[model samples]
Structures are given as C-alpha cells and as structure tokens.
Target: MKKYIPLLFGDTRSIVGVGLRACPKRATTIGSCPYVRMRSLKYSIWVLIMGLMTFFTTPASAALDIEITRGVVRSIPIAIVPFDVNNPNNPNDIARIISNDLNHSGQFQVMPQSRLPQQPHDADAVSADLWKTLGLDDLVIGSATLTDNGQTKADMTLLDLFHSNQSTPTVLMRQSYTVANSQTRALAHHISDIIYEKLTGEKGVFSTRLAYVTVEPLPNNPRHKRYSLMISDVDGHNAKPLLTSTQPIMSPDWSPDGRSVAYVSFETKLPQIFTSDVATGQRRLISSFAGINGAPSFSPDSRSLAVALSMGRTNPNIYIIDLGSGRLTQLTDDAAINTEPSWAPDGQSLLFTSDRGGAPQIYSIDLAGRQVHRVTYLGAYNASAMYLPGSSTKISLLHRDDRGFNIAIYDLQSGTMQTLTQGGYIESPSPAPNGRMIVYSTNVGGRRMLGMVSSNGQVNIRLPEVSGDAQAPAWSPY
Candidate 1:
C-alpha cells in the first residue's frame, strides 16, 4: 500500500495509509476493506478508542440550548494554536475551515493563539493568568510530523484553565491519522472530530460530507439559470459536481451506506428520479414516470426508493422501487396529491404531504395496506417533508406562512411543532449526519443563500454564497 498526505480537499486534508486513493471527486476508498470481514474485532477496537477519547473531554455539540444559569453558560474559550508542522508538504495549509466549523457549532469560543498573551506547547504551561485576562477558558496546541515510513501524523492537546469555581476540568485528547499528502483536509477534519466531541459532549459531524446544488445565471439573462448537482464537506470544502443542466435539481438525499444518492434532476427538461454513485459519479435514471417524476427518497435499508411519481395517476403518488431488483410497488394511491414522502424513524411508516382533507398537510402511511393517517394539522400550506436523519423521530417540513416559507418540525406524539427558520424564504430542510442540525436554503437580501439551523431552531446562520442564488441543500450521510 502507498502512503501519502492527500490534499485534494483544498481547505480540508487527511493522511491515510495506502489503499485509500482518490476515486476522483469522491470519497476515500478503503479497498477490499479487509477490516469489513473482521466486523466484531473492528467494533470492539473502535469502541475502546472512542471510549478513551471521551474520558479526556466533553464537547456540547447538540442543537438544544442548555439553560446554564449557574454552571457553564458561556462556552469554554479555547485557543487553537496553528499546528507546528515539522515540514509541511503544503505551504498554503489554512486552519480557517476547521476554525469555521468549531465556531459554527457555537459550543466553543475559539481565539487565535498566535496572538495569545503567553503561548504554551502542552497543557502544562505557565499562562493561567494571561488566558484568564483574555477571557479564555482552554487552550489547544497541535503539531504534525512526518514519520520515517513516509506517513504524516497530527498530534493535538486540550488545556482547561482552572477557574476558581467555574474552571473547566483538565481534559486531554490525542488522535493520530495517516494520509497521502492529498488528504490533509480530511486529516484536519479528524482533528476537528476529536476537539468537537471533547468540548461539546456530542459527536462532531465535521468529518461528514454534504450534497448541494449550485446555480449559475445565464450570460444574456440573469433571470434564466443553470444548476449543478454538487457534493462536498459539511464546511463547503472539496465540492465536486455530480450533474449540470439548464433546469433545477432538487432533493439530493444520500443512501444509508453513503455509496449512492437519490435525487431529482431535470437534465431532460423534465423532472426525473436519478441515482448517482458517490464513488464513481455514475448516474442512472430510476424513474421517468410519465408525469411529475420527482422528489425521490431512500428507505432506511437503502434497498428501496420511495419516490413521488405521477405516471399519469391523477394525483402524485408514493411508490417504492427495489433498487437491486427494480421492483416497483405503490405505497400511496390517492387523487389528492400525495407527495414529498419521507420514511419514519423505525422505517415501518412513512410521512408525507397530502391534501386528502382540504389543504396540503402531512400524513403517515404503511406499506402493508394497514392504514393511513394525517400527521400535521398546523400551517395551511405544508409541503416537502424531510425526516431528520440518523436516529431521529422528529419530522421536518417546508412550511408556508404569511411570511415566506420557513422550516418546521413535528412531534408525532405530543402533536407539537417547532418552527425552525423565520423571515427567510426557506426550503429544502435536510438534517445533518449528526441529527443536531439541518442545512437549508433561504433568500437573503433578495439572494438565495445556503443556511444551517440548529435542530431546536437556536443557532441559524448562512454559509458562504456562490456567484448566483443558491437553493436545495442536502447533507450527506458520510
């Protein structure tokens, strides 16, 4: 196996042992995955490693805000010292992306240590008074060194300033990863994962990937458009286009294994269901059903796709197709426009939008022909339902109010709902891999911009914009 530091992700990098080469514009390929066969052994070892990392620190990465009137209400201020590279292969490595990730989480107040009153190498340094004066709660010192065997390892540590009563406990964490120079950004993401969980208590989705659509205006007329299907990192790093066309692309949902994505593309001048390989960028039409073949969603098993297809069937219906066998089964057959289908947490039932009553509202249905029920009674117009991915039971929808469209969450049990986004013409609410946040698109200053919202609707911010208006945000499973 070859060893290299991969830097394909301009802003993100990772060092990995050979056999993990770039599939080109895709994710790392753990070839033959020798470890796949040793499932139990891998699980045991991963559990042990993560357990140790947890003991050293707790980072609060959840979307829910904690009312810490007494304890630690303010984030533990931490200084992220630029990694001391023995010999940095890339002279232009910027920690900006990683810093942005930490700040976006809102759990850590990061201060650049290069300007610290007193800089220290490890946790045991003589800078307590300086950090306190600067209102810093902790410090992080990290460095990278290439081993003799032609591999790179980044070592990082966390230091907590001992306050009188509100002092943070000493939590130390170290993680070592290998790369082929091409993966430096990925390596940095690994460091982010460690620091995020260490300080936030919740696992960091920093290492996770993202799927989105990039829109460009035509040369002659700005009103007309061109859109490209893109997938990249959660921090908008390493973006690679999946498909480009003159029409709009929507609903890019990743499969369970992160191997493929099910989305609706209009390359043929009409909406159609398509699946593309995450590793190969290969695409295939899964459904071009006569009329309204759009909004494709994957089942929990990834074996089937619950698609909104009309097939000239009066109202848009929910149909399931076995991806492996191409066996199509109709899940809903109604004339009231049953569309925007999303599977339940347990995969036993599906939640979707319907007007079987009067206005568009959310409804639930089972495949066994058991029964169908209405889920959402709030909001006169609700469409495009998306369930929070990764072990979440709450479902989200694109809700239309007197004030443009905002994202809202529905609790099936209490029948309570939380309106997440406000005052932004928001749409396409796709949950991040960690389930703590959702990435969506909203009109900002009359321009469409990508925005992320905390699951509980606390932290809301827009991502960097592209040349044109952006819409249809999707978070990747990986």
Candidate 2:
C-alpha cells in the first residue's frame, strides 16, 4: 500500500501524483514528498482538496514585474503624446500610464516615444496630416500641471486621425480633472477606461482591483514565514495588505460590489473563513466549522457564501452560509469531495467540483431544486470553474490533459474546450470583468507568479513578484 504524503510546492493539479491530506487538526510544517501515482479517481480528488490546505508562505510586497509572453497578431495602432508638465521631473506620467494600460490589453499597439513626429498637449496644435502619414488611427494628447492648492490638474483630448476624407482630425472627447497628488494614478486609470470604452465599445478594467495572497520568509527566523492578503490595482501597483499573519491565507474571492473579500485563513492553527473589508481592515468571521471550512465564494448578491465543509467528516460537502443570520444550508451531502463552489452570475445555481462520477469534474446544482448535474465531460479532471463574464454558456476552469494542468475555456452548449495557456503549471484562473482576459497563478522558474491570458488565447502576460511567490489571484469586479 502507498502511503499518502503531502506535496507543498505549487498548485494542486499541476504536480501529478502528489497530494496533501485534508483537515489537519493542528498547524504542521508542510514539505515536499516523492511522487506517488494516484490509485483511484476518488483518491485524485482527495489529493486535490488536501493540497488546498498546503500553502508556501512569502513576504509582504506588492510590486510585480510584467512580461508579455504572447501578443495578438493585429492590434490597433495608436499614439499617446507625452503630456506636458510644469515639473518635467515628475515621476507620475499620465500619458505613459494610459499607454501601458492600452498596450497591456493586447488590443492597442502604442507608438514608441522616439517615433512620434510631434508632441502636442492641445488638440488644436496637432497636425492630422502628419499623424495620418504615419498610418495611425487614433491619438491622445494631454497635460498635467500643479495647482496652487497642492492639487494636480490634468487634461486630455482624444483625436481621431482617420476621420473620413478629412485632413483635420476630429476631436473625439475632452476631459479634465483636478485631484490630490496622491490620486493622480487613479485619475490616469479612469482616463484609460474612458479611452478604451470610446474605442473598443467595451468597458475597461483598468480601474479594477485584485486581491491575492503573498508570503515570504521571516527576517529573524528563516524557518517561519509571513503570509498576507494583499489588494492592489489591476496593473499590480499601489498594493496594500488587508491582513497579514504567520498562518496561511488562501482562496480570496471578491464580492460583486467590490466592498468585501472572503478567504480562508488558518490563523487559529485550524481552517476558518472570514470576510475582510477592502477599504477598512475590519474582518468578520464567516465560518469555523468542525472538520473543514474552506473555499469561500460570495454569491452574486453578496449576502451569502458558498463554501466547502467537511462538517467533521473525512470528505467535504458544499454548503451555503448566510452572512446576516449565520444560517447554514447544506447543498451537497455525499462521500465524494465537493469543493470549489463558484456561483453563476444569476446566483440561482452554483457550479462546483465533485468526484461523484469516479473522477473530478465540473458539476452544477440548482438551489431551488437541489438537483445536481454534471457540466463538464471533455476532460477527466476539471475544477476551479467560474462563469466567464458576459456569457453564461461559457466557463473558465483548470483543465488537466496530456500537456499537464492548464487554463481552459469550456462551452456548456457545444461541449467544446479551448485551452488558453501553454504552461502546464497554471491554476486559480479569475476572468476580467469585461471577459477580455483571465488572471491566474502560474509557476515560472519554480516560483509561483501571477499571469494573465486573453480569452481567445492570443496574449499571455506574466506578473512576476519582486521577492517571493504570489498565488491565488482573484480579480475584483468593476
């Protein structure tokens, strides 16, 4: 008989044959173990659930370096002139922020700063002919000046170079904002959202936030590590810790209104669920069940949470907890592991991972009827499923195939699957609000880093951490 040992390096599915035992009564040090091929499908799922309890802690920094691994073949060509500033040495460049925002979306190709024919802060000073000659469709010009009240005044105008047989560019839009110096970055992201919507007709996620877990070894004691739940801008800037502890934090899911974040914390040396306010550091205990209290997902209304609980049993079942009354409603009672509950956009039903069919797969249960049905059949292992924004028929999930575990999009109607990332070690995929991109944690050079991939599989961007590993990224809603 093979002895069950825990693997403590990366995501649950990516590392094959290795798994962690679930519902430990005390906090114990987790270490790497030799590969033990899974014997049965139930055992495979048991391994996956147990792995969720294994966390490798890192330090407390939010600065991430971005690298674009893939790009779209054809992107819209545009140029953003360096905004004129009274203090030329100012570090916050509004124009540069907008440029990076658009470029990172894989929808726009921004012109290099050195290639611009001219730099104009005002719309009237721009020569449309010069830009048209360079085969550009759109141009953005802006200026930022410091006000006497210690506020920054920024102005921007969007100009269309290809205005139907006209030599003069059409003024698409003009806007201005006067805010505190500290809010200049926020203003830039807001402006980027406007420009992106005006051009693409879809709302931009530039102003959204992301909630994730970060950990690093302690300074005095190399053996102990600090774990923190961090919130940062979508671009991975202005990161601040919401909660920090020596214990493990895992599986952060943002509320639809973007006010609270629900996550699993092992601070008491036992697993518990708590919700923390994004603006305030205030926390409210959600669950402290007997055996296992893990995988907390907020419903669409943000009033209740769908979670997985063992309830002092060996295998976990799905349950819902009302945030107001503390009422518990059990959804699944079975011998198989039913975890990773993701709510549909409507909140009338939930999609969860289960091994009832002898293998892990995506399954859905209606709340009113308590009916269970399998949703994914294309793969033997499909978990961590979430409804892709703007479409109920499609879902983004973790799929395991011959290439190893990767992010994939599964269509419920046609039964088709489209793999997004080529990397075998990818997990915890959270789709952007606009359905344009999916952010997930990936293993790079043996370090867990945050990465994003376009829904169509054209673009892949890696957000590498400055110090230790960043895992379990949950993209906030707009």
Please report the candidate that would top TM-score against the real structure.
2
State, as a TM-score between 0 and 1, how close model 2 is to the true structure: 0.85
lDDT for position 79 in model 2? 88
Query: Model 2 misses residue 336 by how many Å?
Result: 0.9
What are the TM-scores, per candidate, against the unseen true structure? Answer: 0.77, 0.85
Q: Residues 3-60, candidate 2: write the lDDT tens digits.
A: 1112322223333422332221111211321212232343444333333332122122
Q: Candidate 1 on 1-478: residue-level lDDT in tens?
A: 1111111111111112112321211012222334323333333233233223333332343112121111111233456766645422233242444555676664544553334565444555545666555545456666666668776666667665533233333545555556666677787777777777765556788888878888888888878888888877777667788888888898888887888888998878888889999889888889987889877888888988888888976678888888889999888877888888888767888888888889999888977773898777777988777777655557778888777788888776787878877754788888876777788887867887777777766456566556676678777775
Model 2 residue 453 CA deviation (Å) reads 0.7
lDDT (CA) per prediction: 0.66, 0.81
Counted clashes in each candidate structure = 40, 4
The all-Cα superposition gives candidate 1 an RMSD in Å to the true structure of: 13.6
Instruction: For model 2, give the 10-residue run with minimal summed lDDT.
Output: 21-30
